[model samples]
Structures are given as structure tokens and as C-alpha cells.
Target: MSYGKKEFRKRLLILTVLISLSFLVLLGRLWVLEIIQGEKYLFLARNNSIRLLPSRAPRGIIYDRKGEILARSRPSFSITIYPWNLSQEDLAETVKEISPIIGVKEERIYQTIEESQSPFNNIPLKEDVDLKTATKILERKLSLAGVDLQVQPRRYYPDEELLAPVLGYLGEIDKDQLQALRGRGYRLGDRVGRDGVERVYDEYLKGEDGGWQIRVNNRGQRVGTMGHKEPLPGNDLVLTIDRQLQQVAWDSLKGRPGAIVVLDPNNGEILSLVSAPAYDPNLFAGSLSQEKWLSLKGDPLHPLTNRAIQGEYPPGSAFKVITTIAALERGIASRDKSFFCSGTFPFKDRVFKCWKEEGCGTLNLKEAIIHSCNVYFYQLGLETGVDNIVDFSKEFGLGKASGIDLVEEKKGLLPHRRWRKESLSRKWFDGDTINLSIGQGYLLVTPLQMANLIGAIANGGRLYRPYLVKRIISPEGETIRETRPRLIKEVILKKKNLDLLRESLFGVVNEKGPSGRRTGTGWRAKIEGIEVAGKTGTAENPLGEDHAWFIGFAPYREPKIALAILVEHGGMGGKAAAPIAKRIFEAYFNSKVGEKKSRKVEE
Candidate 1:
């Protein structure tokens, strides 16, 4: 019994020490919580009690070459409400009151009210409301308890109709865009470029979007900004596209349905590209009213497409340039060789007719081109064979895209024995070659491609990759990168060969006979002292009448500009298309050398 009592006393003493040590450890932990780790826990606890959200950053602005605002962001006042917070009666009452002020019906508000869930705050449906409505709602704050007023940036285009297709426009974020941008930092409600240059330079123009850690009270009112990261503005672009020239081209084709492309012959910078009957872009950005949207949508003229790059047409006689060069290279014809034209050339089964009955008799290469003799090219195609012409045509960037930065550019039809068998499932024949020789049948090309072809000839057989963006200006206004002049291809031809070709082309403007248009067909195109060299075309189409075409260059010795004009159902190139090119040339020279106000380009 004595030993048991002694054991119990010893155990009791150990238990007392153990309890005292545990108490000391607990006190130390308490001290650490109150001192060393206090701030972190305090923040965490405060976060639990308060609701936090994110606010998107401001979007960047766009400027034209002359620092004129093309696209800009303006502060928009929007009203929002937490649909989950209100009772059915309160929600119905709120909807009724909001309907009269916002011009929204009670049905829409009720639908919005029912669609919301209670726990997660549902986003409100209102956007771009005025400040006056918001002020009135704030005065009646009790009636609009869960409502929110947000100031956000909305995009604006100054010259909405002038550059609708090229400048493009922006729109609210879509589901597909959100899915694609999963790891790319885009969020809901962000504005994205939909088309045109806006789509092309999106990365440089979007800038870095930042966010704010906003703390809100129980009623959804903002208490304070917990954290924020300021956004960086997007870089500006300085395009080779001249605003004045663009306007001139746009105004020139106001009522006419045609396409025009003016390019710098030195480098492939596009000075102006105009497709007539364009729709205003401002109609797209807003909540387009039914009547206003219908006004443009119902029009027969497809104002949406960019015809300069998209429209395809046969080159007609203008394509003779290809045939002439091919003939020279294939040893089928020499510069001094002459072909007798009795108004036409009869092939295996087809008769290709010339413009006049007298035709051109025993005409040399210069006269052949000047008169645009179908007999000359037709016989040449038969002599050199189709394979050689196809090979040479591809060399000049035909039957392919010119690699312009526009979207959906079609690689034109370049026909050969192999291409015919694969695409049409038919055997190649002599008849096919004859048509292809004269730039008909399966041969198709865009105006842009033809313009680049002209540029290649003007710059001594070096093809340049045509482009519009001259340079990209950084946020700090420094040039990020400059576009270098590129020699895409050097056509296998001697300088003398190129010169000989130029001389004949010059005769088209200076000489008489079939190529003579200055007398009547295109009398109005003549300008004083400019020395313009050009070719006219009339391409026949199964869908409609012939597509009128004119391609030319000026200051003949030192070529400066190259352009192509196509007027759908418009008459002969010499009569219709050539005059437009002449007018555009007149405008350019008038503005630059003449030191006078540029004249309006005429069709």
C-alpha cells in the first residue's frame, strides 16, 4: 500500500509538468499569431468578410498616317443591377421603374430577373446608358439598391464610311473568341477587332490589358480598390495608305460600280484601293435599329466585300503582255518578226477575231502590241505551245496570289496541261492553249496581281511584295520595324528586252490603228506633259458582259505608279477604264509636282 501511494504521487507530479509545458507552447503560438503572422491573417479574414471583383482596363486607340483619329475609345456610362438580390415583387417594381427610364419593356426586365441565380451575382443586361439616367437612378438610390453604374471605354471610328472595309471594326467578346483566348489573357466583355487591318495587327493593337482588385460592400457598392495594375496602350501604325488619296479614290467611284488600285511602282506600296458602293461601318458597332440596318443590308451592291483583292477577272487584251514576253523567251518570235492579220487568226477549230477588219498586216512586235493584235498572240500561243506560256505566266506571279496582306486572297487560275487534267478532268487540247494564250478560258487574275505585274515591268523585271503598312510606330512613337523593298523575282529577261517591251507599250498611248483610243474610245484621259504608257482590256464573262480593264504607268522612262481599274459591264478598256487611270495619274501629279489641289479622278 505504501509503494502504490508513492507511484501515484510520482505520476501526478509528471502530469503537472506536462500540462504546464503544453500551456507554455500554446501561449507561444498565440503570441506568434498576435505579432509575427498578424497582418496576413488579418487580410485573409477581411477578404472572407468582403466580396472582391475585377474591372477591365481601357482599350487602345488607332490613328491614321497623319495622326488623325481613326478609332478611339470614349468613356461610356452603363447601369447594371444584381438580379439575384431582389425579391419577385421588388424585382417587378424595379423593372417597371427602370423600363420607363431606359425605354426597355417590363417583359425584358422580368426575363432578366428570372434568369439570374441567387448565390453567384448575375451580370446585368444594360450597356452604354447616358450619365443623366445614372444620375437620376442614384438620386432614387433606395429604389435601385442593387444597381451598379460602370464607366467603361467604347470604340469609335471617325471616318466610318470612308474606310469601313479596310479599317474594319471592333465588337464585344464572343464565346468562340473566349475559348480560343483561354491562355492568351482575354476576358469577358473585351472588345476584339473583327476584320480588315484591325484583324491583321490585333496583337500590336490590343496592348496589355490590366485589372483592378475591387472590394465591394454587401449591397455591391465599391468600398475601395484593394489592388490594381495599370494597362499599356497599344502601338500606333503608320500605313503607306494616303488618307487624301484614299478619299480621292473613294469619291471618284461614288456612283459607279468599279474597283481601283493605285500602287507605287518603285516598291509595292498601295497608295489607294477603292471598291465602290461601300457600306458605313458605324452601322455595325452599335445596336443597329431594324430600319437602319435594313437600309444597308437590302442594297443589291455587295458593299461588304473588298473587291481590289477579291474580285477576279480575265485580263483580256491586257494579258497580251504575258503572251508577248512568253513568245520572246520561247524563241517562237523575235522583236522584228511580223504577223499578217486579216482581221482574225483561225486555230485548229476556233477563230479568234481582232478589233478591226483591216487588222494589222505584217506588223512587227512594237506594232503588234500597239494595235493589240489578237492574231499576233494567237499564232504565238500555237507556235510556242501552252506549257511554255504557263511556265512564263507563273514566273510573272500570275495564277497565284501576289501575297498581299489582305484576307481570303484567291490564287488565280493558271491553266496548263497538268492543271487542266487535274481540275477539269478533261484532256488538254490545242483549243485550250489557244484561249489561254489570249488570256481567256481558264485564265483568271485579280487587279492586285495585275498591278504587281505592271510594277514588276516598271522596275526592270523585279517583282515587289505589295503592302500597305509602311512601318509600325511603338507606344513611345519609335519605329518598331520598317518594311524593306524586296525583289521577289527577277524575270529571265535582258534590260534591252524590258526596254523593247516598254517602247511598244508606250506606242499604245502614242501610236494609231487598233490601239488608238485617244481619238475617241478614251479621249478624255489625255493629260499634258506626263507621258503615260498604258494598255486597255475587255474581258468577256459568261455571268454578264465584259469587264472593262485599264493598266498603266506614267513618266515612261522613270516609271512611278502602276494601277488597274475594272468596271463591271463597263465598255472597252480604252474607252472606259483608261480614262480612270489617266484621271488618277492626273490627281497624283497635280498634288505632287503641279503643286495644285488634286483633281477628282473620273471614270
Candidate 2:
């Protein structure tokens, strides 16, 4: 019994020592954490309760030259997930719970989470959510952990389709863009400009994004902001476009499958540019559905195409202006030299017939221009030769991109001896020259190039590099940059020849032909009080009706505005395209009168 009691005492002593040592160790750990390392752990605990939420800065406001708002950002709600705060199973449950409320599929949400490079970063689950849906998410905040509601900026175009082609639309940054721009602070799912000026000036328009350190309760509800960095709004853009004139030009198209470009002849400032079959840019403000995207992609009219710069079509009779320039400058045809048009001109094996089968008899250079005599030009083209024709054409900015500050600018086909040899492995023929002289046979020009061409003629042969943006203003209203008139080249036409050409173009609009029974080809473009000088063109398309073209400058002598109008498959330039020019001219002159009257009243 004594031995057993001794053994039990020994065991009890061992238990007491072990227990005492454990208590001592616990006391030392508590002291260290409460005193020496207290601030560090406290900061860590506070950080666990604090969440960093991104505050999207609104993109710059786009304004017309008249101070009219074209595009701006509006506040919208978005839901995001903090991956670090949730495990895989937790995320699945949270996604499933919020899927029906946000109208996003569980699979998509999971895929988004999976694509995230870091668990510490926030993943966007749904963007641009409605107020009703956002309220639902907030109401279920207690049940939905790691999900956050944020207010972000959504791009909006008040004019919608009226300026879609120029203003463009925004879309999420793709893999390639993200990879290229990641170092520049661009992240996945960032809204980037997909086309138009948006793409061109994205660097200026996009602002610095800011964020807030928000404190949340156990239920994932916001308590207070620990700290925040205020978002800096993007710079503002002032375009050279005149909203009133832009509206007039757009209205003139009237849903036709064509384009219209209006510019200041003295400068390269684009006043109004319109492409028909426009789509609403507002459709892209939110997450575009597959159905909507497919519909836009599948449309036959291709509403997304900016016809002003992208659509390449034969200039039709517009090429006559270039041919006339080549003829007079190269000494191939004199102003008084008359050519007899016998309704058709036979070249080698092929015969080319004029539009007027009866014929334009004994027409001089000026007379032929007014009449748009195809036979007269056919003879002139052969004499001037294709080389000189191509040279003069390039000098006038044809067969190449205009270097306009827009994307997708196509360099129109400028066929020559080398191009013929290399592209078709064929020799140049007289038939080809006859066709080229009349703006037919593989000759293509964009509407922008035509506008630039006419602007050069109006401004006395000085070709200016066409520009759209007039000024870029900072958010604080300071001018960051301003655009000046940039002269590309001068055609250096003879004063006498230029004067006669101008007069002939004036006659094309204002004067009747030698045959009083018929007016000039551009007669329909005549305004009551304004003297307009322009030429008309009919591009023959074997596939369909001929494309109509009319390029002109208004106020004849002291030209202010120049226009290039194209009506695809619209039979005649005078009938289809010239009338549109008349309306646009009337609108511009009327607006100018109204502005003067308003200024007088102010004075």
C-alpha cells in the first residue's frame, strides 16, 4: 500500500509540472502578442475587416464644336467578388445564390473566377446591373459572402446612331489587348474603345481609376470607409464637328446605303461625317448579348462599316475633274481645243459609248466638263497617257489613304503600268486607258478622299491632312492640345487654268449646256442665292445599278464648305447625289444666317 501511494504521488507531481509549464508558455505568448507584437497583429486584424473596392473613373466627355455633348459616362452598379475572402466551395455557393438575382449563369461566374490571375484581386461577376437587381443583392448581403456592390461609370451616347461611326463603342479588354496593355495599368475586363475616335484617342479619354478601403461587418455589409483615393475624371474632347450640320448631313442620307462628308475647305477640319445603316452605340454600353452581336455581324448592310473612310467605290464622273486637271496641266488638251463626241469612241477591238447616245458635238475643255462628255475624256485620257493620269491622280490624293486621323482608312486602287504588270501580269491597253479616264475599270476612291480632293480644289490646290478632333481639354477646363490646319501638299495648278476650271465647275452647277434643252450634269445642285461649283459622276457597276457621286464646294468664289456625297447603286449623280448636296448647302447657309442674326441681337 505504501509503494502504491508513492507511485501515485510521483505521477501527480509529473502532471503538476507539465500543467505549470503549459500555463507559463501560454502567459509568455499572451505577453508577446499583447505588448511587443500587438500593433502588428492589430493591423492585420483590421486589414482583414477592411476591403479595397475599386471606384471606376468616368471617361472624358466628348463634345461637339458647339459645346453639345456627344458622349458621357453615367453612374451604374456592378457586382464583384473578392476571391481571397472565399474558398472554392464558398464561391460556388455564393455564385449560385446570386446567379438568378443578377441574371448571370453560374458557369459563367465560375469561369470568370477561374480566369482571375490572383485570389487577392477582385473578379467582376456582373457589370451595369439595374437598381432593382442591385437592391436584391444588397438585401441578401448577409447570405452572400465575398460579393460586393460597386458604382461604376457606363459609357452613354445621347445621339446614339447619329454619331456611332465617329464616336465608336467600348468593349471589354481581350486577352491580346490585356497582355499588351497590362503593364500600362490595363486589366482584364477593362472597357476599351473598339473603333472610331474612341480607339484613336483612348489614351487621352481614359482616366486614372481610384479606390476606397471600405470596412465591412461580419455580414459583408459596408460599415465605413477607412480611407479612399478619389477618382480622377478623364479629359474632355472637343470635336471639329458641327452638330447642326452633322444632323443635316445625316438627315440628307435618309437611310440610303451611302456616306456624306463635309469639311472646311480652308482647313482639313471635318464638320460632318455620316455613314448610313448606322447601329445604336448604346447597345454596346452594357454587356452585349450573343444574339445582338450575331445580329450586327450577320446584317447584310454592314452597319458597322464607316463608309466615309472604309467604303471604296468607283468615283464615277468625279474622276473627270482629275482628268481635266491632268489634261490642262500636262498640255495634253487646251481650254479652247474642241473635241467632237460622236456618242461612242472605238478603241482597238472594244467600243466605248457615251451616256448621251446622241452625242455631245464640238465641245471644248470647259464645255466638256459641264457636259461630262465621256468620249471627250476618252480622247483626252489617251493623249495624256495612263502614266501622267496616275501621277496627277496621286498628286490629288487619290489611290491612297488620306492619312486622316481615323482607323480602317483604305488606300484606293491606283492602277498604273507597274501595278498592271505585277498584279495582273498583263500589259496596259488603250481600252484600259479609256475606261480609267472615265473613272471606271478597277478605279476606286473613298468618300473621304473625294472630300479632301474637292477641299483642295476649293482652297486653291492646297491639300490639307483631314482632321476630326479640334481640341482636347482637361477635366479642369484647361486646354491640353489644339489642332491646327496641316497642309499636306499643293497641286500648283496654273492660275489661268485654275480660273477656267473653277468657272467651268461653276457652270456645271449654275449654267446650262450648249444644248439649252439639257442642263449641266450638276444642275440639280444649284442653290437659289449660293453659287456652288461641283461635278457629278455615275460609276457603272456591272453587278448592279451605277453608283452616283457628286463632289462640290459652296459660295463658288470664296468657298467655305466642301462635300462628297455617294449614293451606292443610285443611277445618276445629279438625280440622287446632287439633290442631297443642295439640301445640306441650304441647311448650312440658313444656319449661318441664323447665327449672324443671333450675334446681332446679342450686340
- Report lDDT per candidate: 0.74, 0.89
- How well is each residue in 313-356 modelled by candidate 1, as lDDT tens digits? 78888888888788887677778887799997776576778776
Best by lDDT: 2
Best by TM-score: 2
lDDT of 1 at 147: 63
Poorest lDDT segment (10 consecutive residues) of candidate 2? 83-92
- By summed lDDT, which 10 consecutive residues of candidate 1 come out lowest? 594-603
TM-score of each: 0.82, 0.89
Candidate 2 clash pair list: 317-537
CA shift at 496, candidate 2, in angstroms? 1.1
**Model 1 clashing residue pairs (backbone):** 521-575
